[model samples]
Target chain A: MKLFLYLDRESVVHRLHPVTKLVALPVLFGVAMRLERLETLALLALVVVVVAALGRALDAVAGMASLLLTLLIATTLMWWLFAPQGGLLRDGFQPAALARSAGLGLRLALMVASGIVFLATTRVEDFAHGLRTLGLPYRVAFALTLAFRLVPTFVASGRAVAEAQRARGLDLDHGGLVTRMRRYTPLVVPMFLTSIRRADRLAAALETRGFGSGEKRTDLVEHRFGGRDALAAVLLVGLVAASLWGGELASQPAVQAALGSARAWLEALYAKAASRP
Target chain B: MRQRTRPGVLPGSAESLGVPRAEIARRVAECLGLVGLAGFERREPATLSGGEKQRLAIASVLAMRPSLILLDEPTTDLDPVGKGEVHAILRRLAADGLAVAVIEHETEELLDLDRILHLDAGAVRRDGPPRRLLLEVAELAAAGVEPPVAARASRWLGLAEVVREERFADEVAARGVQVERTGVRPRLATRGEAPVIEVDHLVHRYPLRDQPAVDDVSLAIRPGEFVALLGANGSGKTTLAKHLNGLLPPTSGAVRVAGHDAKKAGTAQLARHVGYVFQDPDHQIFSATVWEEMAFGPRNLGVGEDQLESRILAALEVVGLTEERDRDPFVLTKGQRQRLAVASVLATAPEILVLDEPTTGLDYNDRERMLALLADLHRRGHTVLVITHAMEVVASHCERALVMAGGKLVFDGGIPELFANDEVLARARLRAPTAWRLGRMLGLETLTPEELGAALRGGGGGNGA
Candidate 1:
């Protein structure tokens, strides 16, 4: 994984304070999980896509689309096969079962999409800074930032170890699942050793740099919540409220009738496919 | 008044330290400018090149306004250009009244500093001016330090001690030493045989980057040839080396190793013919004992148990690690670990050896021992390709030199030809070996100090000074 997910772009979503973005992720996740109707879940997914587009993060979304698509397919299939609320449609087409699985799948996809948007818009340093501003200890915030920074370092080290092993004729590709995993197990030893050595050096470097020298640390960049950030927070709170109440509204008679019509249309399409020669 | 410079403090946070933000900004800018990274404020530290990262590290320290800055081998893994840049920065810092102390192994470059402290076994063996101590050849050799080439040449010619190249040349001219204009021609390996490794118009672009790391580069290495690959940081030396061993398949074009297509063959198959030794030995050594480390390659190749012992023993003997076979590899010295890394590859019995900066962090003796081992391998008919920044190693060891610049093969020829070509050197950001530079100034051609001394002594005339 990349160390930093921040895409350099000028957009309203990117301009929001990082704390607002952090708050929006959990709020969106909460709403996504609580909403039961397929239409509400689809609407949440659309909202996430729109936010990603506003942040100029479509490219990142496109890059992750294949992985996300795989997740969507896997989740949809698992839910269709194993969901307790729906029975397996072995005898004939079951529109209610299909709708239930699709709703769960769409809800999961929306949660992941919202997370991607938040990561893409917020810089790692900004996240740490926001955490510090929210009363996290400076040491804890710095450690969190350093962990993010070390992700790339560890990745590069892991690659080096793999390459080194490959050069030594350790065949990692042509093997059974168990055999391949066993081949990779040795790599962990060297990687861990290298990380330990690097940590030692980094500790020395940090100590020499007065990391814990008893001075109150200062931030180079200060973020303040401006009018736009306040607006974003209010919009986020309103969305959360809607998500909490939207489930009851969707169960109302008029909404149920609309969903029933949509379900009939989907069932007809499924039947047509089932009737094909 | 007393001043304290806290290490690891962010240069950007001068405001919370009761300093004005504008003053912090000015200080940061000045420090960055001093380190030659003026416009890289927003660049991630991880994204910077090794040299640039070291410079940035120094810049951060400089931001603290430290009176005395101590750096431990700041140029350990940097390319020659990077090393020179860091040295230049240190010189400037020292000139600006900041006491700069650096722990480095490449003392020849550090000879220009105010004083020299020669240490051996963690004890000071000599302390004096660089000119006096560096020229004391026997004393330095006893102390396990490699004296400057100029000093060695001066001693060989029975002249007074001279450490600097320009001073050595001036002394030679003043004494009216007749240089025979003879140059040392390296023994070029026979070229009639089919090339063992062939790269045809190779191009490798990383997934995220717009441009290729290894551009349209083509080269062929014949059997038993010793070649040096020279380039600055991010100039594609390592990328090109990776292609030879199938560690990295080309994005376009072809790479053939020992008649096998690198792109089609797995890395294991390529490992049988081209053994790649990485820069850091720690990345490869995981086994507890040296014997197990040596046996890893052959074991991976599925060598018979009967032959595995023999192969490990023979490889250990080659690297002179037989005495340390039972010891844990982690406990071995840095030099021993590097030798073990080579021995591990040697057990696979590959014909072509690709080493990426083997002498990077080794002390004088260890570096010499490693080069001697390579020389021994070359004598055993192994085709050796070394990626290195040490011009002296190229001058004394490799028969041919390939220079890369911006991912393209800019120059390929004999080492002397490479040294004499100023344009290629400038493009590649490489300096000629010290003796060769002195020879150029004196209207002669030479690659090593012994050759320069022989030329002054009017030895046999046909390019063997």
Candidate 2:
């Protein structure tokens, strides 16, 4: 029923300028992607978690954990099964390949976690405002905000349509996979029609509200980069630098020793379990 | 000043057109204040209630500072309280010297307007003072507009004019028409059978809400009973009705429909007993043709082809949509689409029917037809439950009234008893039918104009016969 992911809270992360938070997402992703070490990727994920906690968006983040976990497991299994470099194990389990895939999964998880943090702390309007500030056309920014606004409306309309169909004996729950998918095919028509009608109404409403009046639009809530925003932006830049630096430092003796010891511990546990079975 | 105000040019456009920011802000605030939404400048439009959103729409229009404002059926989908609020705002706008024109089918509330332009088939049928035009009952009825009950009462009682409640009361008292206290309470014909729908301690709390949408509510509806679920917006009437059909499970309670526990029965199974008709016909309608729409329900119910064809034909005939069967559902008029929605549900052959605001956005003829259809269904032994804000519909059609307020069942009684209780009416934000109001003033408890007229002609008071 909630229309948006914008959590209304006052905290360090929430207080940062929307542009700062918006910039931090790409920065985190860019650095996390460039880094090959699992330790650095895990460290970036920890940073995202810390920021989300500071913004009191942990609840929202936690709500998404299950979906992220599914993605993680899928990506890890895909990489382990098809890894081109690592040789397969005796029983074709591919432990070394699985380890490499775990690293990739951790990197993707960090990227997704950073995106979640950014959305949870930033209001949709603020994102639009940030876009406007970033020199995007007002119409484009407005469209983005409108898209966010329509998400909840479409969700509610979809629910209503589903309920209406259900009341007429449309049993979506008790059907075969293909049958259910075919049953849902009928739902798309109504949803699309309703969405089109709503779009017409919304366009008329927007025009009546002077949406494209060719005037210099004024924002109600103005955002400025305050001291906290500046500090957060600095910290983000430092974190990105550290992550990139960690990728280079991954070949160092001590870092390699630590990674080797972690792999040893994992293999020892796997061997112990295998021997017991 | 006489230029046609094109849509899409809002007051904000003025600022974009190089108007001073201060001036635009002042105008926006003033307009919002005019619509009683002064402190809602920062509020998102989606978060507003239906009434508030309507008001905000008007405010946006008012911010344009147009000399003339036109609203098309502004109160159609709103609850009684929301309707009243919008009406008050419109009256204020008109009073402020704005040329306010409203096109609406519901005339009772608009009877106090300075002028009314009655239109039919895109032609002006009548244009005159509202009171005079409404009093011409024959012409009004010819145009498919139900004259205000007071106007009908005045015509029947030979009064010169009585559109206003106090004037009608005074005229009745002065005429010495001894309004007989018939005290005819609406009673459900007791079949003594078990109730078809039983709700006990039903409480439904939506996620992320601090309070339950449907607070602990209990009721038993017997077979063949025609009940109106009356409430203001957000009063949980729809929530409670949804529970009966198993559309929504109760947070901490139980609903039994046709001897099946609603919590246990799947909605598809519950559909056999309770058919729920949503408010917006467009939301439920998706078929390429009316026939396809009607066939959807029975097909889902897995009825045989021959029986399904029969069911579809019977439902279409009941809703008078037989001729429109081959036509695309989206191409039909709003009323036809609404009927198609009802027919689609009836195709499933439910024993209990629940319609949510079935008459909304419908013209007088369409509304009467819809109600008549429901009445016919009720006559055939289907228990009918209607969630409506139309007091006149409840007064005239339904025998029992269940009023809800603040998510609680505040009152359950006969229609006469409901109108007679001022406290309950206030709590539920419902207005008594004009006939009921006039009758109460005259110490009678009539629910409709016909009842009042009959009482007057019965020689109860020396005024009429």
Candidate 3:
């Protein structure tokens, strides 16, 4: 209920270069994208779960997983109800379709799971530093930091304004739409005015500190991409190669012939159930 | 007095009201006492004036009844009467066994405080009662807090001491530094050159306010004139200032900077002539490096790269922020950040300067430095306009003063004359300077400490001294 999931310590996952993590997450998703069999996708999901545990991001993963499960169950049920391949007899509910649904669900869940692990382990400042290292304009990087700082500030201001409004006895809870919007006028005006004023002050403060005339500037904190970055990149490349190879094998004539036979058998069973009358 | 009880109040009701523990009745009573709002029972806090609202915030906290209440520069935005009233309440709270912890930069008021906790670079530099700490003027300087009045006066007289409150009366008597009868005319500076800013029939109405913030106000400020604007909160000082540099447009009035119409010229164009330093520094700093941040305005104006560096260096020199050029603005103390804001604006090299509540949230040393910087600017012939509730700043620096109330200018005259008129100032919710107060006590009409000093040295008046 409190929704506190951003707590973690320095670990192997945390130390990996953010760019490498960014690249690796998509590669993992691509692997899931190529896999059609439910069992193989489930195995991939299991790997994600293992990685999440190793990264000490299990709590975050669990929260995402629960959300994924709810969506997956609802979507699968809806798909099954009007799936076009469904039969009238209750006894003849095809297991293959259910397997297919499981495959899709596993694929989607694993892709989301990997993303959660990556973000939970990363620090915002490191991400900004990484942007700068990757040749982003310095202004953009600093602006991102300022924007991030502004979020908490804006939230705090919002709370302060809300408290001020409540003290004034402006009841926001039981108001009409127009009244609610009107009540917000006072709060919004002050927030905007204060933010502008703050911006002005911040500008002056920054200028007075010799912010713009740097012959040379020093960074108080440093970020480095070490051995972990190399290892992670290598592993990601290997996974992509393995996934392509697996896709090639799955697309072979022999594999296709076997999958076709299984579909044919399910069709015959449905035909028999329809002919029961 | 029997403590009144509320029937079945919520567990954290006091906290919800921005006060922690006292009963609702006591909270209301405290608010009423502070604001002089009587004959109201169970009235919501939202209907109070800006000053009243601030007091209510303080009273709400008082109700929570903490043994030690931490107030962060509570009087920064308040006028004299409101500030005085709040101070009275705080004094009462202290007397009632509350260990009040106040972090403030106002030096004159420091004399009345019980204890002063001086911090420097995140470390406690000094912790003692005000009287004892006042004597360590040098040490206080190092800690970036201003010395008390007598200490400052002593410095002017070539005698400084580490004074504590118990010795205040004896030391002043012994020093033979005359406590002057107030109201004397020091040499006034000649207003030079043409008007740098001119406004005629200025009217500005914020979308929210029922009436215009600035109503048909006409004024002109010449170069090298130190002008101060005084008013109650929301009386349109800031609104009028925003129009000076084209940040805001007058609804039905004309604002011209050096004969160029501000509204017609646009903000970017007017920015070249009138450099506006915001009250807060964070809004304008959009760069990772301090060097880059300072270059923004100049870069926008298309100053040559070669010249930009020199200008920035000069600006930094003025504010004394040259050493921390690379440090993140976020990491600096509030006072330091404010100075940085000033330096950034100065880097652009505008002719006229408009500052809105520039001293708010600053510690004493920061305020003094800012005042000194303004004084230096005045000496350099830059037209400066400041909006503040602080009569001390007005007294120390300003020659001319403008008082506004209900979005109208009530009085506009010389600072001495303005403060000497009690009726006009009271109507505007502004207090006369401390010197003026002392001078009035001595039946003198002077507005500043220097004038009072002169009057006393000449043996020119009353038994009040």
Question: By lDDT, who's the top model here?
Answer: 1
Best by TM-score: 1
Model 3, range B91-155, lDDT digits (tens) per residue?
A: 87788788988777776667677777777789887788775677676677776766655554344
| Tens digits of lDDT, candidate 2, A173-277 | 876899989898567888899888888987886666567676666664356778887788789778877776755677899999999999999999999999994
DockQ of all candidate complexes = 0.35, 0.33, 0.01
Whichever of 2 and 3 has more lDDT, that candidate is 2
Residue runs of model 3 more than 4 Å from their true location after superposition: A1-277, B1-50, B95-99, B110-144, B150-192, B443-465
TM-score of 1: 0.92
Cα lDDT of model 3 by residue, A18-48, tens digit: 6777677778988989987888787787778
- On residues B1-465, what C-alpha lDDT tens digit does candidate 2 reach at each position? 111121121344454445564566677778878989877765666777888878878887787677888898898878777888899989988898999989788987887789988888888878888777887887777777877887878776676555477776777667776666675564756669899999999999998788899999999999989999998887889989999889999999899999999989979998888899999888888778889889888888779998988898899999999999899998899888998999999989999999999998898888889989998999988899999988888988898999899999999888877887889988888888888888777778888888888777675552331
* CA lDDT of each prediction against the hidden true structure: 0.82, 0.81, 0.68
**What order do candidates take by lDDT, descending?**
1, 2, 3
Evaluated on the second chain alone, the candidates' TM-scores are 0.93, 0.93, 0.79
Better of 1 and 2 by DockQ: 1
TM-scores of all candidate predictions against the true structure:
0.92, 0.90, 0.55
Q: What is candidate 2's CA lDDT for residue B162?
A: 50
